[model samples]
Structures are given as C-alpha cells and as structure tokens.
Target: MELRDISRRVGIAAGVVTVLALAAPYAVLSGGSYASQLADYYASGVVGGAGIALFALLSVVVVASVERGNLDPGTLAGAAVVLGVATTLSAAAWATAIEPSPMFRDNLWLVWHARVVVALSVLIPVAAAAYARELLA
Candidate 1:
C-alpha cells in the first residue's frame, strides 16, 4: 500500500466518523429529545459553524489527496493534523464529561462517539507518519 492510498483511506474514514459524531446524540432533555436532532440544533451556533467548516475542509482534503493516478502528500498530512486535533478534543471531552454524565450513562450515541474518536486518534498519527515518510523518501 502506498502512502497516498493509506492517507486517502484515513481521510475518508475521518470524514465519515465526523458525520457520525455530529448525528449522534449530544443532549437529552425532559419533554423533548434533543439528542436525536443534534445536527439541526448545532447548525445555528458558532460551534456548529466550525464543525461544518471542518467537515467541508476534510472532505475536500480527502478528495484531493487521492486524485487520478496522483497523490498529494502535503494535503494528506494536513488532513491528518486536522483529524488529530479533532480526535484529541473529542476523546478528552468524552473522558472528562460524557462518560461521567448521568444523562449519558446508557446513551448509545456517547458510545458511538467515543469509538469514533478512538479510531480517529489512531488513524491520524498513522496517516501523518506515512505521509512524512513518503515525503522524505
């Protein structure tokens, strides 16, 4: 497997995971189910805007990283860095807040988010290293 191929796969996976995280339940309230419509809720806020931008950038990077018989190592590396930051933030939040919250004790969305963050954390470093190696080679 080439560095480009590996990075392209990771980028795609990261984008998918981000989408899943956004769709996952963020909160649950009495008399209303906010968790089910996380994206709709977050879509109107500053944080939501950032998330949207991140997803857009990631999608572009992933698509650009894997072109017709060509590879963009720099773009792949950039994507890896973005994924790394996202993973760190998500994992830290999960460990410090989500897992300890009484409301999320039985939340499947929390579990899904946690799993995706872990996957992203692992993928980011591997993709970055591969891209770096390819560049050096």
Candidate 2:
C-alpha cells in the first residue's frame, strides 16, 4: 500500500484506541449499578468519560467519511490535528475539572480514569503529527 494509505489507516487506528480508552472502566461507583455510576459521573461539573468517548467516536466517523473518501491528505491531516487538539483539551478538562468530592477523590478508579484520559490525549497529538508529516512530505 501507499504511504498515504498507511497513514490514513494508522490515524483511524489511533482514533479507535482513543475512544476505547475514553470508555473503558472510568469508574465503578458504589452499589455497582450502571445508573449510580452514571449519576456519579455527571455529578462532576465536567463532561464525563462517555461524552468524551462519543465526541471522539464522531470525530473518527467524520475523518473516515469525509477525508478518507476523498483521499484528501491535507484535509485529513488538518482534521486530525484539530480533532486531536480538541480531544486533548476536553480530556484534560474532564480529568482536572472533576469535583474533588469525597466520592470522586476517594476512589482509586478516578485516578485510573484520569490516567487513561491523559494517555489518550497524548496519543491523539502523536497520531495527528504522524498524519501531518506524511501528508506534508
């Protein structure tokens, strides 16, 4: 396959990985009920993990449908960069803006959640950079 094709595939792969990180076991709040977990998550002032995941998922679809279909390398790279930066900011906000209530802070799960988001945030940029470098070359 061409280098452009490889870059496109890699960008999609990175985006999928980011979505998974956003959705995976952010926290298992007390009572072990899904509702309770959701409630606890939303109680935080910031957007929850699910929201971040959904946004990232939509971004991936846009990349696949719009950029990939047209084989527009420059547009694809630009989209990747914009999406990556937005995801990074949103993830960072979600991780940091979470209320420091006992419920949130007391759980080790919250720390893990932050770590996952932070990691994904980093991955987005790297993926974007890779795509941009290939397109620009």
Candidate 3:
C-alpha cells in the first residue's frame, strides 16, 4: 500500500461522504441531520455514523493492505485517530451546526452519541495523516 494508494482511497471516501452529506434530502430520523424522511434523531445519526465508519475503515484498510513497501502502518492508525476525532466533532456539529434543533436540546442520547462520534472523528484524520504524509510529504 503506497502512500499514494491510501491517499487516493481516502480522497474517494471523503468525496463520497461529502457529496452525500450535501446532496441528500436530510431525513433527520433521530438526532440532527435528515436523510430521506424524518427519522428519530438518534436513528438518523446512523447516516453520518456510516460515513465516519467508512473513514475509519479506510484508515484500517490502508494500514492492513499496504504495510510492506511504501505504506506505513502508523499512517493507518493516524487516519483512524483523525476519523475518531472527526466523528466526535461531527456529532457536535450536528447538535450545534447541522441540526441543533431546540427539540433535541433536552435529550440525553444525543450527548451520548458524542462518544462514538468523537471516536470516528479521531480515526479519519490520524489514518489519513498517517498515509497522506507519507504519500504527499
């Protein structure tokens, strides 16, 4: 897994997620952002959660797939870490930026959602950084 390969994958995944985030009808199933229909805020959060998971998975895969030649394992871990951080922040963004509806202000689960959210956030950056630095720098 050369740095370029991992970086490319990250770019693709990021691009896909970004596009989805922007192009959807935003269901708002559970927590904040809506997708198709208005789901529970918590359930709706799964959409973003999938994206976070994809980011983390990309880090993990890059690490696992291209460990021999030019790819560094640490890069993958770094990507995972960033993804985790991003996930956490994303949840906050939803609460504050994306959704932030007054209805969820009193909710408890939304706060709990932050835990996994943060984890995803941390994972992506660390993973991408791990590989991206190697690929780019």
Clashes of each: 0, 0, 54
Which stretches of candidate 2 lie above 4 Å from their native place? 1-7, 26-37, 42-47, 65-71, 100-107
Which candidate gets the maximum lDDT versus the true structure? Answer: 2
Tell me the tens digit of each residue's lDDT in model 2 across 12-31: 67678877666555333435
Q: Whole-model lDDT for model 3 versus the true structure?
A: 0.47
| Candidate lDDT (C-alpha), each | 0.50, 0.64, 0.47
lDDT of 3 by residue, 29-87 (tens): 34344322233343345445455445445544544455455755555545545654555
For each candidate, give its TM-score against the true structure.
0.51, 0.70, 0.37
Question: For candidate 2, which ten residues in a row score worst on lDDT?
Answer: 25-34
Encode model 1's per-residue lDDT on 1-137: one tens digit a residue. 87666765665565556555544444244225444444343443333424543643465465445454366656655555565556445444443333234434555455455455445545544555565456546
Residue runs of model 3 more than 4 Å from their true location after superposition? 1-47, 68-109, 127-137
| TM-score winner between candidates 2 and 3 | 2
What C-alpha lDDT does candidate 1 achieve relative to the native structure? 0.50
